[model samples]
Target chain A: AQRVTQPEKLLSVFKGAPVELKCNYSYSGSPELFWYVQYSRQRLQLLLRHISRESIKGFTADLNKGETSFHLKKPFAQEEDSAMYYCALLVPGNQFYFGTGTSLTVIP
Target chain B: DVKVTQSLRYLVKRTGEKVFLECVQDMDHENMFWYRQDPGLGLRLIYFSYDVKMKEKGDIPEGYSVSREKKERFSLILESASTNQTSMYLCASSSQPRGLKLFFGSGTQLSVL
Candidate 1:
């Protein structure tokens, strides 16, 4: 079965510190990965996708096929970026699967 | 702009009562999904509909049922609301070619007492 895994339950970083949230998936074929962010009192929204290879709000994720991982990274953490991050996968069907999510806290 | 809205932001109901959570999308999406958010479970798909009057069971669909009588509306039904069923329910929709990239609504926080 195809599954998405986010290993961190809570990730804490200081302002201007580099942050990396680890995610690994189990899949045999090409993967379509996405990063979704949920801020306090806000809906979960799409941040970026691996297919687009673009950066949203200074955060970028690279898809590593060999390792079967798509880790979300940011050079300088911001207070506004502190939110619950979820990684999702798209398989052959339109059905989607999501990770357990990582709660990021950027301390000042 | 695409928009998905849940009918209720917060609801409190008693046990054994029938509860209905309504969702509507104005983007004319073909796919709509219902999920329950828990602390460690993240988002567990409860049910989904690909089109009007068509529904499919998700990973955990035991205590819940769905109705998609219209293209823009999907309703989640809980036959007998229980304390364990109290959760943050979310509604999301997407297009067919857009694949699994979903646009979500502000979730409904349901409390069963």
Candidate 2:
């Protein structure tokens, strides 16, 4: 079975501090990974995908096949960056397995 | 932008009542999904449809059913709503089978009392 795991349930950081949300996955084949974010009262939206290799909102995630992890990171946290983040893994059948998100709180 | 619209933002209902959550997308998506979001469970897929009249059970489909009569619409049905069933329901759509990105709707927060 394919699974995505986000170990942190909640993370607190002061503004301007570097932040990292850890994620690990278990899959047999090559994986397509993604990070989705939901702001307060906002719908969940895609943050970044490993395939795209692009940064969104100063957040970037790199896929590490050896470790089977795709962790989300940001250089400087902002007040507006506080939100719920989810890690997802896409398998061969167009099925997506999502992690039990991490709630990031950027304190000023 | 792709638009995936869920019919209700918030709903309160009594236990044992049958519930219907409607979702519509204007993006001509080939795949649609229904998921339930809980505080610690994140998003658990209840059902998904690849095409009109073709539905598949997801990770958590025991208490729910789905209908996809048309390509643009997918409906999730809770045959018997329970207090434990109360959660935020989200609907999403994707353009193709290989597409990893999905467009989501404002979730419907359903509370069973």
Chain B vs. true chain B: TM-score for each candidate? 0.97, 0.97
* Candidate 1: Cα lDDT at A57: 99
Interface RMSD of each: 1.3, 0.7
lDDT of 1 by residue, A51-108 (tens): 9999999999999998999999999999998999999987765777889999999999
Q: What lDDT score goes with residue B60 in model 2?
A: 90
lDDT of 2 by residue, B1-113 (tens): 99999979999999999999999999899999999999888899999999999999999999999999999999999999999999999999997858688899999999999
Which digits, one per residue and each the tens of the lDDT, describe model 1 over residues B3-110? 999979999999999999999999999999999999988888899999999999988899999999999999999999999999999999999866657999999999
Number of the top-ranking candidate, with lDDT as the measure: 2
Best by DockQ: 2
- Residue pairs in steric clash, candidate 1? none
> What DockQ does each candidate score versus the true complex, computed on alpha carbons?
0.73, 0.86
Clashing pairs in 2: none
The 10-residue segment of model 2 chain A with minimum total lDDT is A88-97
